[model samples]
Target chain A: MPGQTTASLPRVAITTGEPAGIGPELTLMLAMQAATLPAQVVAIGDPDLLSSRARSLALDIDIVPCRPGDDLPAPQAGRLSVWPVSLRAPSLAGTLDPANGAYVLDTLDLAIAACRHGQASAMVTAPLHKGAIIDGGHPGFTGHTEYLRDACGVDEVVMMLATDQALHGVAHGDTSCPLRVALATTHLPLRDVADALTAERLERILRVLDGDLKRHFGIVSPRILVCGLNPHAGEGGHLGREEIEVIEPTLNRLRTEGLDLTGPLPADTLFTPRHLATADAVLAMYHDQGLPVLKYAGFGRGANITLGLPLVRTSVDHGTALDLAGKGTADPGSLRVAVSLAADMARHGQ
Target chain B: MSQAQPCIALTLGDPAGIGPELVAKLLEQRDVVGKANIVVVGDRWVWEEGQRVAGIHHEIPEISSLAEARDQTGPVLLPTSTIKPEDVEYARINGLCGTSVLEVLKLCMDGASAGQVDAICFAPLNKLSMKQGGLKHEDELHFFVDHLKVETPVCEFNTLGNLWTSRISSHIPLAEAASHVTSERILSATQLIHDALIAAGIEQPRIGVAALNPHAGEGGTCGREEIDIIAPAIDACRDAGYAAQGPFPADTIFRRARDGEFDGVVTMYHDQGQIALKLMGFERGVTVQGGLPIPITTPAHGTAFDIAGKGRANVEAMRHAFDIACRMGRHHASR
Candidate 1:
């Protein structure tokens, strides 16, 4: 109790993603139990929507309103700080309203602006529907990831997913770990994954991943295992030349720059305990190559972190659940972990 | 099965490896003994040596010929060939050991073709020596295909727990993985695995097909192979009287499979399913040579050259391989 109100706690801004989706409901659910977290959380959205979702879900969170320039209160039991950004339209549960698309972007922009301006130490986002945002007339909106990249004005950013948990696989005597997969490429066509995978691109991803693992995760000499583009990591170029040519040369260059990188190993065999023993994270060449195992191992209980951004940012790994928006049946585990991880990085990543 | 229990040909894959020891240990189980009448095809001396290393003293009745092996079997260890322990090197891949492996495989094939054995189960074989011994086939699947001399399609299926995965392209470059994801290839793989499931005793095995791209192409924005190639293949399979679904995202389908929603999966590439399956259960996985004329299965793992004679090898995969062989043997025999 003595150190409860200390200045050491980081202030993290939480963006309620798409208003028509479960973002508002998830925000209400997580904020009701915010006192246990390592930092104070400020929900950046309409206070009316938060109160309405809380009333519908029977969540007992006292919503304290804060203006842009007002003094923020420390997070406490049964309370969450609200930075009231007005909604473009009244958002209803289980519905899609493209009219509120600009409002969703507005919340993300404010949160990013707060983190960049040092008003909040970090930002955590809930799920937002890309279709609704596009219908609402925002062009070229791939997702929050690309949006965040554009917002941060960074040439490249790494997308990584991690969870500090494990599950024993019954049939195989297999076990899971806090495995992380940082992707070199995301959302490209299957035809394009090969051409998109180049030495220059791989080096940029490794640089961001390595720097963040040190700056945020506190790994002094981060040992990153890289996955080859092929099934057996090209099986010595029989499967693909990218590993022997592109990935190998890039990793060689990175090794001289003082980062401990292992592999271009077979993606199939790289997830086992033998390879994961001395590694901090796995740098997967593409999306499906890495995510399936990570998601299966994590069992839907993990957070996605944006590495290489100037500001600390973490978000729910799942997308917007439009169907379960009003039912209050959605699991808030990912959002909770996302917030906790953001706070952890905010406290330590400085 | 009541008319006559299935007679299975069990070969010692690489005597230098753990095949001999695994068969010796596996036969000690009552369930295995009662499940089928087995014709154990291997070098008796190699098996005897395995008995010495594995410390099992169970006496197996030996037979002189494959003809005698057919009619008189409670459990007969048929000596297809002989290799003395003094001459054979432990855990080393040599031309001699490779020849023995190929010989046992051929003997098993002969039994299956002559209808002497209903199915075949063998231990892990190393390709290096198989090549040195003049095995021109790149993979055993190719060897099996060439040896059988049939025009039927065939592929190697990697299985764990109750789930099976058939890849559209295997042992190929990831860069070339996309071009191979055509509708014809998908249909062929689906049909092969579907038929393999039927042979393994599933009346109508539900198969979940995986997408090549991250989010199943995120509706062609990420990759169009799912919409253009995989979806049509599933439709074709459905129209052709098979129960198949997907082009589902590769990442989440395993979760569904583990939850018992489907019995098998057809993956786009090797690691799409391998990463999840191996991570879920590496030791228990079994590799079944699907779409072959005769039912054949082996332990998904390779010869543990590291722990060859130390008696440290876990027989879980071997037991599963034996179980699948017996089940599939009975099913194939019944049909």
Candidate 2:
């Protein structure tokens, strides 16, 4: 709503992640109230999985099967347009099926194609099982971000998580409500964090983070607060020299390009209101440095946004949540927020 | 103590700042007074100035020297008064104020050494002011070690309520922090914290040792320090009949520690746990000088020179420091 100046509803592709996971179930819930969405949603998954999940959830929703070439119909309550991808096996509740992993990857592939070709304005994804995908013989499958990056053929990308709940719903039409935290190094050991962070890598992340926040989130000038790799931001080179050696130089270089970047500040005090008052986003040196605090603040209602993607992409901040998969206990708040944010970003891009 | 009540030696650390006032405010609570027999070590002028600044007019019994001190509910003030309120500025650093702190520390340590008091808890002390006053002690722990003259592995442990954190390599460069993360250091820090937690009254202290590398070095892909150093230290500590666990990723473990998952966390470096601990409880933190002859504690916060004599300082940390001192005092006495 912040950047939507269009008359027509934006078309979005929602990929139902691992069929054995809660992704299929959450997709069904979204389809139940499809009419209320600001964007026209075309779900990418097996139609049979959707029908089964809807039946299990006891949701009365109509599945309209379609493909990329078809003219999409107007959205209404209890109506879901599906880009059918058949599952290798029937997915049961609270169970993992590695055989159907290719089906999950197939959905992402179709959604990525639609978003890439401008057939869909953006893509929203549910949680997928990485282990199951690997078991399905896709060796060294990292995550959704890597899969999308490889598919898009882009070299650099940034992963960011955000939530606007703490803004007290005051960001109604304003985009400055959410606290976005991007990581410099993800899924690396604490020891490798010091070495993995290079000036060039840091600049690349900042450039991507800066460009996407403006183009996608509708921010004119993004003020990013950068966290130091070491505690106290190296305490002026006593704790660690990553700030002085790598982060500071990169940030300084980025600032010369007219990016309003602040910090190498202490991660401990950075999350407080004193620093976050004017921040558009925070760039942390590692996963835990920024995430523990952000997850603490936005745990239940957070969305994971993949910056630097050619098209807008948003995801639920949570994982497959296997235990709550078929039990109807999995929270849909994050997925709902992700879809809403994706719609806004898509509209803004237009 | 052999006596019915435990006598504690309390010091008003820095006269120019909030320590005096916090002590005065702490004294106004009758529960604190009844818990231990507190003999305050400072100049009468400073104590009275603290009373006037904090707006408390409690009638405290004063004694002139350590020889005259006694165990009682009433605060026995050993007058080390050298700097008067008129001579020293309220917030400005004064040599006489710092000298008075060192003077009182000597008296209290002597009393503690001679078994005159069960434990010692000083209000926040300004190290800079102490340095400005010609005091050459590097830190309070070093000063206590020289005074106690006992050879034992000593370190600083920070605690917020029930949670405690001990570090292996403190006040070192983060780059160098990894190189110093040896098995011996981790074992020592874990043991110290374990012993301290026991002294603080946890029978079997569950101590979580943090990993030097993130996610415990991700099985050596990230860094081999955790595989090489931290894990072995933890295994050694466990083998020694201690409940030391982890080498957990620093970020996630702090949450677990705060949620009462572990009694103490042995960290790799200073800020690894500090950033989390301080953010979790800024005002309610206490610093315990572990591995010493007597239990020594002070407010985790330093002298608030910015907000000094206006009597608006939050005493939550000071109060906890007092509480830890009392609790550890009883435990240390029987040991």
Number of the top TM-score candidate:
1
> What are the iRMS values of all candidates?
1.5, 3.1
lDDT per residue as tens, model 1, B1-335:
42357787888778778877888788877788777888788877887877777788777788876666657647888875545567678788776787788878887887788877888998877666676666777467778888888687677898997788888787677677789888877888888888887766688889888888878888877877788778988999899877889978987899888888888888887788788877887778888888778989998777777788888777888899888888888887877
**Every model's Cα RMSD, please?**
3.5, 4.8
Instruction: List the lowest-lDDT window of 10 residues for candidate 1 chain A.
Output: A168-177
lDDT of 2 at B135: 66
Q: Which ten residues in a row have the lowest lDDT in candidate 2 chain B?
A: B64-73
lDDT score for residue A248 of model 2 = 83
- Residues A157-185 of candidate 2: C-alpha lDDT, one tens digit per residue: 99898775543233433652366789888
Q: CAPRI band of model 1?
A: medium
For candidate 1, list the clashing residue pairs, or say none. Answer: A172-B281, A189-B222, A239-B173
Output the TM-score of candidate 1: 0.90
Model 2: what is its DockQ?
0.32
lDDT of 1 by residue, A16-54 (tens): 988888888888888767777767778999999898888
